[model samples]
Target: MKKLALNYVDTFKGLSKEVWWLALITLINRAGTMVIPFLSIYLNKNLGFTKEQVGTVMVCFGLGSLVGSWLGGILTDKIGYYKVMVGSLVLTGILFFGLQFLETYTQFCLGIFIVMTVGDIFRPAVFTALNAYSKEENKTRSLTLIRLAINLGFSVGPAVGGTIIVAFSYTGLFWVDAITCIVAGILLLKVLHPKKAKVLDTHENKKGKSVLTDIPYLMFFGCMVMFSFIFVQLMSTLPLFYEEYYHLPENVIGFILMTNGALIFIFEMPLVKYFENKKIQHLNSVIIGVLLTALGFAVLLYTASMYASILIGMVLLTFGEMVGFPFSNAFAVKRAKRGNFGAYMGLYSMAFSIAHIGGHKFGLESIKAYGFLQTWQFMAIIGAITVVFLFFLKRIIQKEK
Candidate 1:
């Protein structure tokens, strides 16, 4: 047992120093993001906003993220990943600190939008840097580790954030989140110094050929937008479902979400590695994931009891999430041109932002019009159709290949 443990330690030691720093940065940044899971709660409870108004405000945050993703790619191409990430983190931290003073609904919405936009700008730069740094053989594992760190933060951050909110106020939560972002920014700037490469100078090269010209990449992003539209329901609609139907307490909801995060942290890496070598057609993984996620929603719709059924549904959702996310990233990376990796990643992140806005706007209104179960049933149908569309799309891309 001791020898086995030693071997594991040695294996970790063999990884690139950059991977370790990336994972640490991911964890810290994600810890700061804990505020998101409870943002709806804070707005409704503390700020006295209606559900529709909250949804509108959240869309502003999504809009900021959409713009940030594009700007991050451009900046990364010009100044390199490390500088973009450092700048993003520092600005985000300042914005987050400023959030404590926001009392009015408009102020809250605007503050969150600015903070999310500046903070999320680091995503594409960071992902591109990790992809560039990792060996082909270790790329999946490295990405998985980064994701695990994110989930680890997800697990801890919500539970802690929820506890703080319960004990103190939303202001305290904002302060903690802001401090963590600043600390993470400092650590990243000190540890990871990504040198600018001439290869990534998009301006000096072809002025006509932009990153958006890549069709397969655009299709992939389109698929992700659809996927996020379905997935974001978990955040926007599911809590309302639990509250209305089961009368589940907020703390219980937090625990359930923490369970999802814990499961992802435990299983995401191993599953990614296991599927790494399979030539299973990237779209197939996506299709399967979508189908599973749809099934999770169906289960939730039928769930009469609270704990056990919800847990089962969550497991399925997490499993689907694990399969879907990394493959989407890998597919994007595979299709991206060498110098424009950050741009591709940025485009990819924009899909999620778009989906978040679409989901919140659509999901809430749909539930109001159709009723929760019927609305979810419609979502499941949409998810299945999306998978079918992607399957055909994959065939076309494969034929081109």
Candidate 2:
């Protein structure tokens, strides 16, 4: 037990102080992430919108995210991540506050679209900042550390958000989210300002291959889109499934989802460290992650014990996320070594944005048309197809090497 504790502590060694600061800011920002997880439920139960209407609103959110990510990449390269992160976070906070005022279906659809457009701009800029802040050898661990903060915050957020919803109202979530964003931006501005911290500029001036024209990357991008499409159902439709299908309460559902974040917080870093030390291929780890994610959903198909299945299924998905996301991020950073991280990570984020548009719509529509069982099956099949694509991507990477 002592050895195990020491091993976990060792993962924190060799990281730059700046990376730790970055992770701290991420923890604060993500800790207030109370809105998105419960957005669909709020629309359905409180606002009395149909699932179809909620789907439309979410698609709009994805459209805005797509625009935000593309614009963020360009701006981060042209200006710098410092300005982009500050502006995006502060503006997004204000927008979150404004969103509570929107009522009608059309109003919500348009409002959420604009808010997400501004909000998601933070995604690419933050990624670029990660590249600047960490050393080359420590990049994957740095990314994992950031993810650890995010999951830790997530573990806290939904559980707290559930209590807020119960004690106050949905409006309370916006206030907390808004305040956190503003605070995070201000803290970032004070601590990570370019004047104080050393941000690398070599990648900024270097011309790299256009992501649009990169063939292998384009293939990987498609696989990510599919992967995200399957993964996002956890946010969009899964809550609805818990509510309508299983008849679980909001707090119980929140705790169930919280289990994913908590488990990742406890296990992901050690797992990534193990994989890294073993020198496993990034593609191989990602393939395993994808397969496990498929299995996570498949577990739900067993209807014997509701409590047991939900816990087990969430455990599978959390492990899959733990393995998949960090390596995939490192892979993108490695490819961008020749060029600009802003552009590469921007396009990488855009894949999730695209999935956002399609995934929410697909999941909601599938649930509406067929049923939850069929939807889970479709998600599993998509994950399997994505694993095949990743194998081809592996070959392409090897050939390039």
Candidate 3:
């Protein structure tokens, strides 16, 4: 048992110093991610908004994220990712401070939009930096490290968020969240220099420069949109379901949400590495990953409100997350073809926006009209459909290759 534990520890031993800083940066940034997870709750419980209104407001966030992704992609190509990432963190933190005062619905919506707009631009830039900073052999592992850092910090966020909300109310959530973002920005500025970063543009060409003409990349982009449409429900609807249907308390909800991080922290890198070393196909990983996500939501149906049920669902979802997302990112980087890695990442990041529009809007309406059970069922069905579509899509991409 001791020897086995030592080997597990060694799995994380060989990452680049840049990768370590990136992970630390991600951990710091994500540790304060209390606002978004509880945004629906804040609107509902604190401000007395209806679910429909919350959904509408949330879509503003999605629209902002869409524009940000495009901007990040373009700006990364021009000024490099360092400036974009640092600016996003600092500016978004300032916006979060502004959020403390907005009480009216329209003001809150506009605030949400602005915050996410500046905040989300960081996504593609971070991935671009990650790709630049990592070795090609460690590409997928570096991506996994991003998720790993996120989940590790997230596990702390919800638990701390729960405590903050209890002691200070939702206002505390925003304040703490802002502090973390600003601190992360300072850390980034201090630790990572432009000269030290690795920008991978292995096979640049006239054709590689323009993602607009890349059909395979476009098809994959579509797949990512569809995937996010279903997967993002975990963020958009799952929390509401816990509050409205399950009647879970903030701390309990935090604990449940924390399970996602805990599982990934314990299992993902090791298991994902194990599967990759065994020569498993990337497509197979995605298929199982999507299916497991479907299963996660499905668990909610039979075991609604049960503590064990939520845990079960989280395990499935985390397993799916572990197997799938890194491969999906690997696929995007694979398609980069050289100089346009940031552009590819930006395009991929837009899927989060697509997911927000599709999942939040569609889900709120479904819950209002059909009920939570049916809504989750609908999301699961969408996941299943995406699997079939991905199967076909993978075949086409492979044939083209």
Top candidate, metric lDDT: 2
Local accuracy of candidate 2 as per-residue lDDT tens digits, 79-140: 98889999998998999999989889999999998888888888888888888888777888
lDDT of 1 by residue, 101-149 (tens): 8889888878888887898789898877777667656665666778788
**Clashes in model 1: which pairs?**
none
The candidate maximizing TM-score is 2
Clashes of each: 0, 0, 0
Q: Model 1, 176: alpha-carbon shift in Å?
A: 2.5
**Position 215, candidate 3: lDDT:** 75
Least accurate 10 contiguous residues by lDDT in model 2: 199-208
For model 3, the local distance difference test gives 0.82
Question: Per-residue lDDT tens digits of candidate 3, residues 1-401?
Answer: 89978867877765678888999998988887678878888998888889888878878878888988988888877787899999999998889888989988999999898888898889889988887777676778888888888877866777789889999998888888999999999999988976665445333445456787787678777777777777777775888999998898988887787677677887888877787788777777878888998898888888635876788888888788788788888878767754477788899889768887776678877999999999888878888887887888788877976
Q: Quote the RMSD, in angstroms, for model 3.
A: 3.2
Stretches of candidate 3 off by over 4 Å are 40-52, 165-175, 196-207, 236-256, 298-313
**Window of ten residues with lowest summed lDDT in model 1:** 196-205
The per-model lDDT (C-alpha) reads 0.78, 0.87, 0.82
